[model samples]
Target: MLIDAIRIYCQKNGIQLSTRDKTLAADFFEHPHDYISDDYFNYKLHSFICRSHAELPEIFIVEEKGNDFLVYERIISDFCCLSQHKQQAPQSFIGKKIIILREQPKTLEAEALYATIKKRISGANLFFLPLVAFSLLLPFYSNLFNSRLVYSSSLTSVLYITIFFIFFALLEAFLKTSVYKTVVRATHDNSIKISKLLMYILTITSDDSAPSTTRAIELSSVSYWKAISSLMVDVALLLVFLICIVLLLGEYSIILFLYYLGFAIFCVYARFQSYESSLKSIAINNDRLIDSISLHNNRQQVRFTNFDTLRHAFYVKSLASEKLSHQLDLHNNRWAEILKLNTFISMVLMYIACYLAINTGSLSIATIIAVMIINSRLSAAMIASVNGCYSVKVNLHQIKASLTKLTQHIVLANANQLHLDKIEQLTLENITIEPHGHATLAGYNANFTRGNVVGVVGKVGVGKSTLLRAIIAQAALPHGAIRYNQVNIHNIDALTFQRQIAYYQPALQFFKGTLRFNFNLYGIHDTGRILAIIKYCCPAMTVDINILDDVDADALNFSAGERQKIIISMLLEKQPSLIILDEPTSFMSDDEGLDFLRHLIAQHHDAIFIIASHNADVNRIATTLINISNTGKHKKIFINTPRPTVPITVKPQGGLAE
Candidate 1:
């Protein structure tokens, strides 16, 4: 349990591990963090012992029928040390046993994300609203001119309106540039916010035991872009719509104004109904295909369901969508009937008003013609604006739903400032990881104080990747502690902690962007570093390493090996303190993989590395190798000793490192 680990950690630190400290530990476990100082976690020990893997004693916790239930190195407190996990446990594992010597995690808020979008959209409206007001007033020039053409007065009025339009056009041009920049900036800012949430979600939901599957969290990769893309257009149209309404009432009759409002409402409502049906259709179809696509992307060859089966399933979903569309269309058609009634009422009102004016000799045929033209133009603008507003509202509501779904599962970085500048060491103490309640790895004990290449070797299905994820995240322990420096990782902010650690798994994807974009993610802009990475990854290409103009050559187009190399190169450029690779070089050629590692080891000798691979040759490079067993037991082997080596083939028949 984390309370036990804390007592041990406190014992080593010589801090008074009081009974109140136990209460603090319990509270910290439930909350994960409770605002402790970084210095409180300093794990600098006074004494340590080094021994061969075989010489180390295995400490068993429980036994059944004389079988080992849990086994690891004994807690020789005077010399005990543990590896560090740099972040907090997932939101799902709130009460699980793990060292969480920090403050409680706060809920991620969608309001913060929406506020950024709102600020930008509001700024754009400042420029657009005034232009729309002037455009709406353009049709009311009849009020300025004489009813019958006084030639001089009419010409003057026409010239005055033209100059007014030209003046507003100039203002529009001035604001357009600023508005465009603001929109782009806001979209980019929103992308960063969504990206943060995506990462947080991935961290919590990486394990099967997670409350939900977030591996290919559909929201992370695509939704924000869709939400932000059409926002400005909607805002502009809405401004124009409102301005048109005001102008209608000012230039025409109350009846005409009412007619315009009613027509615009019906038009927007009908369009919104159809738009809603399409949204439902899209959502249904996405649900139908998402699992198959996710499985295919994961590179799993196992056939769960057949192609014809998928086809039939999609057919069923499509039928539902079609039915939904039909229902919406029926409702719209009914509204269309109401619109006909509205048009009849408007026509009758127009005739009465026009008849009264004509009889009073106040309106001429020319003036009536002029009024009709203005009404026609005014209705089009009003309808356009209303439809735009409705579209944006629907999109925003959908996006907010997605955000809410994700925020519930993960705890994001707190508003309170935190930073993990570097990863100096890692410590793990008697940690048992039973993912989905299947005890794949148990009683794993290791002290990696001086960061070095650490490897886990085991047979197929013996939880090598599972253990690696335990250290690298995606899998949280049920008991014990994984601390970095001295602070429980569960107390540290996930994103801040992640900044100091680089994790690469084969299933991860890169963005569809330029070479510079991939490399520039860590805010490192060293030209030499980028050139070195590009030269190693893609030697055959003649493209400029830094400013590769091929923007379209993103993740989809790149080969598997190419994508892997690009990600590795990005990690190398950033030079994080801890580098974790789970089959990272699996896609690369043997020679290519070796060459990349040679460069990596040379540059990043100080960083801690946890590499899990099937290749025996890969494990031979590690300073210490831990052999994982099928019964969730571990055996340590010191490979870097001075002894004559005899090669033996290690197969996947049983859980052994050989």
Candidate 2:
């Protein structure tokens, strides 16, 4: 159990060990109590060596704590120079606890994770209350137009109201800035968690029905609170303004309010009718525009065809189509114009009502003007409230759909099960590979053992790469089972199984960072091993030892062959148990390709190699060959020869030079 914890920690942290050290560590773990001097054992074992030591020993200590184990490491300096007597004595050393081996924490569901973020940012909603309250003061402005007060008193009143308005407006602005900053900080802090959630979803989802990257990002960063808060604030302000209007102008205000309410209902209905159609047209046009831009960026293809004319015409056409879509949507949705017309009609009715009230001696001129001002403000608030409600409904629907898609195909792992230490045999039992349209391959059975190089050969579009994907569990196998050491791949821990496998394809990408980062992305940081592999695979290329040079802007400077060689070298440095290569030497010359195959067959003889290629030389070097036909049938050919168990040195004579 202690050995398993140490091995898992090393794999996760990218630590590599030599063959001798692995054997020694395994033996020590089996008889750990024999080496300990204490009577109680203390559930602690120390002095186990790992890969981090040079002349001195790097000791690993494991302490059992209930169901889990805590692992620590300590480096002893100049231990070789110490006297034998001193080495025999009991030594005490402090170690740094590196990791704990326990059940991984259960990942929170997408809805639950979103709710936690919403709760943290919900404090920003309180700021809307003050903003709505400040808006209530707009109705009071009608007092300034009154003629009863003296000039000096009226001027003083205007000055005080202006001051209050400015103060409240500034306060609202400050609160808005604070909320913006808070949201930004929260988003930044939770970015890693959000990324993990996205990866988890992708890992468990089928390849054919995976969600788009843009949609996933949108769902991960959705802020429904913005629309909800806006709706609530507008509704509250509209209600308060209506109440004030009713209190000031009794029956007339009620009649005007009812009229506006009916108009608002009509406006909402029109908006709903036009909203979905507008969005669909815009989305389609946007996709077309994006495609045109991507085509334009590929200057090579266009230059060979029409010398920039085709790209220019395509972009122009897409842009015009997008503009037309936008114009049509705006023309169809006339809710904003309808609201403006309602305001104008309400103003005319208010003037008529005021004239009647004044003639009947029911209201003074100043009071009538105040009622007109309140009515106008109420109409404006009602428009905003209706728009806010529409926005909230649209956003809520989108969020609900995104969340449902995210959780629909989730595959949860059993935390109580322990991972396998090593994968000895992989068996594919009557597997069917259904990547997309039709079933590419079906009823295929194969068994792969350690130290066997299996070559898969097929013509273009014959599902060679798909077969490799199925083996690694990246592509779905609908009609069969893939087992690792007799256990189904799905039942095993995904991370643990992936750690023992390395996959290389023709379309592998490098990130926009230093070469060191790209090389050590999987945690193998042995400088000597990396330099050696680079020298052997790419003899003509030169690079810095620290590898601080950027590979972003000038990545194209490296030829395709050079990039493939560098990526292959990095993969070999990991020393994974299973290596899957798909058309690995498509960019290399025949001589270079042959040399690459010879080198792999010689070195790393203990690993299981699955190479898919059309090169005849690759088939000649393999112990077993699988030929896939056009009808999705496969024929397995076995070469009756002993598998090579010793490493041999081979050098490339051509290709990958400069």
Candidate 3:
């Protein structure tokens, strides 16, 4: 099956079979399992197949029968290979024999993956235990030779101990390096999985419910490093605490042991309190800063007197944020001082304990020295561990919060076998339109077919836009189903369904790019048709035929009416089956708006045109008018005879849709 898919792809792209290495192809086919198991072998075979090409292939075909192995039409790009093409670009693969491969089987859920990473980090941290033991025992062992307490001073004994220490230290270093590399590689691989999962969540989530663009990026990329660092510190601290316990058992000094243990516990408690307070302060400061920045950014939108008031408010927020930040810094400094004082006290107690042990002859001179050294190390490790635990707590809290926000409102729907070449006979079976959880339109039933113009009219905030959003599957329909050719809209693949739609709103903005780039944003590259449409829409506005001029900056150097016309022209260039417009002519003059509407209706006579507007002229031009009341009910106001609800039969295609 994979071979057949690859053959079809090559044939469609006009790649000659004579160019392919027949020997490599035979090897790939005969021992397909071997190639599947070995990524290097698979890459060698696929590379030979596309050796004649230059640009990397955007589509990949994978065998579904056994171990899924991808065959690229061109050489794979670095990013594609690194990400493993986890999310397929459905539109790019449309009309091509491309098989969408599943991501690696070991990919876990976001939370599970985080847990696994933590476990691996902890395992890697175990390598530090031996090193910690060596450090603690070294002082005692070295002092033993100097004092001649445990063994008599001799060259053989000294040499034997020196070699053993050297050999063990080197062995430990190598083991640590190997374990660290393994953990690092695993973490890198899992980070990609986390990113993919987060992207998928963002794609499926509605814009209103999703995180801000900055926050999404932070969660997907920035948080991975923070998480790994925090986990390492957390695990290291745990190992330190365990070593402290071992020291207590070996020394048989309960008082000293309890003192250090109590100090470690106190540090943890103090740090947790400080971190919680600091986090709250940081959040408040961030909110204030954002408020001030937002006010300044939108100063142009405010009136002169209003702008003065907003400026004052912005100053107040800025001052508050600065003050809060300063206070937080002071608080952190105070905690640092307290920690230092505790450490000093801890060292003093250790010195007094050692002096008593020496006076009572309960411990040897070497043992006293070792205790002093271990006490100092334990004090430092405890302090470091407290900070690490705080960081781990905060990072995990953020990750969990982001996961909850994304998952809470997601509505899971099964993939269905419905594809539409051209949408015809759109039926709204008692749909309840709701935007942002507020019901705006209830039990609205409508059937639209080709050659019909639908005008939706309503008062301000009366749900005209919400109705349109419901039709496009952007807003949720809690009560009913929207069907295209007798199949539910939800059942149709989104990419395939949207291909036949051209939805335009007055709020839509263009990316910062040239006219050609904007026009070709939706895969429409006919320069002649684009120029013709621009000419037709705005005759007075002469645009470059080559369309190399940049329009996104300063609203493309066009007036509001001109920009609207250009946007309309861009939409018209799509030649979509369903055209949805919301207050599309709000910026244009009445006569020009009516004229444009007439031209649009005439040019797309066979298409379904749905326009939501308050203009009487639009109502006059429309065949069916839906009047939505402020109470969220729809009243049909027919302007002309509606088209017959005849379903257009389209052949269903298998697999996923574009």
Candidate 4:
């Protein structure tokens, strides 16, 4: 009957509650991520229309975005409760008062860590300094001179250089590949923070507006210069060792053999050290880059203030980076194709170097053979290095692309957008937030009179908890205005509003702590109110005075429900104006839950109470019974009783009020 009356009132006021509107209303009630995936966000306009009655119209406005619409409902008056609203002509309701609950998305901490690490590593391209330096100087070393190790005659020198270079190239190529795989395995062996990876990737590929990626690349390139410098030290040392051996064995050929062996070992160690150092620098750089990007991200403002527009804006912000990565991949692939030609050129150069040295009379058949082999090895190493460079480029490109999409999808859902305002009071108009998963109250519209008990009963998922979040303005809703006192609460900061109503749900999460620490929160000293709440809420329980001083109070010693009660006691002691107890009985043994409920009711008589449960025992003591259930087609909510109070008999000294 109330819903019908509300519908009639809306119709008389020219309010249009179409099926589209209902679908849209449902969207607001559903989880944001779920709504986005199911395309329910497309119904924002329809949902806005369902909330209008004759009294308030002008306070809310709607705007279009692509195929969807966004509704911005403003609160112009302090009177947001439906019962208190004065009715007028539909047209006169244009700019009436209303309250709005907005949604904000926050960034995850884990993701921030990942992005920081990525930026530290990839932002500069430091890995290349060693490669370029070694490549340019390898030809001057005497290991290639006067020895039959890589060449003999001009033609034989070419063959021998090719053979020796192939072997050296194969060994280095194998070792570099092994090192890369090892690093990848170590860094990602455990739980990886997905958000950080995306952050670093997005910054690298994002447009000019995001310059961190460019900065990161520069830093990365310079850092590798240090690795390259160290490799040069080893190279210079090997040249001296080779020259000494050759001078000593000028008459005996064995000195040449010893020099070649020592040279190979030095080359391997130098490359290994350089590669590892470069990789470490890259990882560190990635972390710093992510941190810088995050700081900048926080400073930027969204153009649209509405939730729908804000969500759309996120997609727009991500587009530039996504496209940039795609273009980079195309460029990298082209480079990969060109490197195939570079490989051949490197091989040709190796042969020429060996032939020239053999003809100079400094290399005999053995020395020429050794020189040719070393030249072939150098050629292969150059090709492998080129391949690794392209590989790094591709990995970076993909990481950025994947990160943009991932951040666009995941971060918006998990970030901390909830405000923490302390609310002194709350008022609900004809406001109805539809039931989603496990909502306690579906359609009932009633005020939580200060210091009164309101009990709610419904089937599972009837929107009981939805009502709580709605009153707090965390979830989306329609069909009513909610106010705190004369102020249309929609205008008030939401975080402050949420802090007013203290809640204890059955699924209340417990962190690692002692019962006393959980209740007191490391607060200095204790209060009488805290002691009183524990006395009333916990049967056969007393506040432990020594718990404050106990060293082992925060260990895992209590039952789940016991911990819940402690949280409840803490909230009750604070004496919030509005209190919500969701399924307080569900978590405990039947008797324990019942005992707790009774105690809560008796103790909190002066606070507005909303008990959400299906237990008949609880409903018997309620002043109001709200039924929330879905009869197949849609959700239906009704107030079963109002202003109900049981009479109690009084004895001479100790008695119940009858």
Candidate with the greatest TM-score versus the true structure: 2
Give one digit per residue, the lDDT tens place, for model 1 in 216-237.
2334223434333444444455
Candidate 2: 10-residue stretch with minimal lDDT: 36-45
> Could you tally the backbone clashes for each prediction?
19, 0, 2, 87
TM-score of 3: 0.68
Instruction: Report how far off residue 451 is in candidate 1 (Å).
Output: 6.2
Error of 1 at 536 (Å): 8.2
Give one digit per residue, the lDDT tens place, for model 3 in 199-269: 65676664443445326434434444545554454456446644653453345455556776787777777
Assess candidate 4 and give its lDDT: 0.47
Candidate 2 lDDT over 465-570, as tens digits, reads 9888878877666689888888887777744454567788998867557665565564434556656766676677784564434345234356778778778767
Query: Each candidate: RMSD to true structure?
Result: 18.7, 14.2, 13.1, 24.2
- Candidates' C-alpha lDDT: 0.55, 0.61, 0.61, 0.47
TM-score of each: 0.55, 0.69, 0.68, 0.41
Give the lDDT of residue 370 in candidate 2. 69
lDDT at residue 338 of model 4 (Cα atoms): 51
Model 3 has a clash total of 2
Ranking by TM-score: 2, 3, 1, 4
Record all residue pairs in model 2 with backbone atoms less than 3 Å apart, i.e. clashing. Answer: none
Q: Write the per-residue lDDT of candidate 4 for residues 406-473, one digit (tens) a residue.
A: 34423223222233233345566665645543223334455656666777776667677776666644
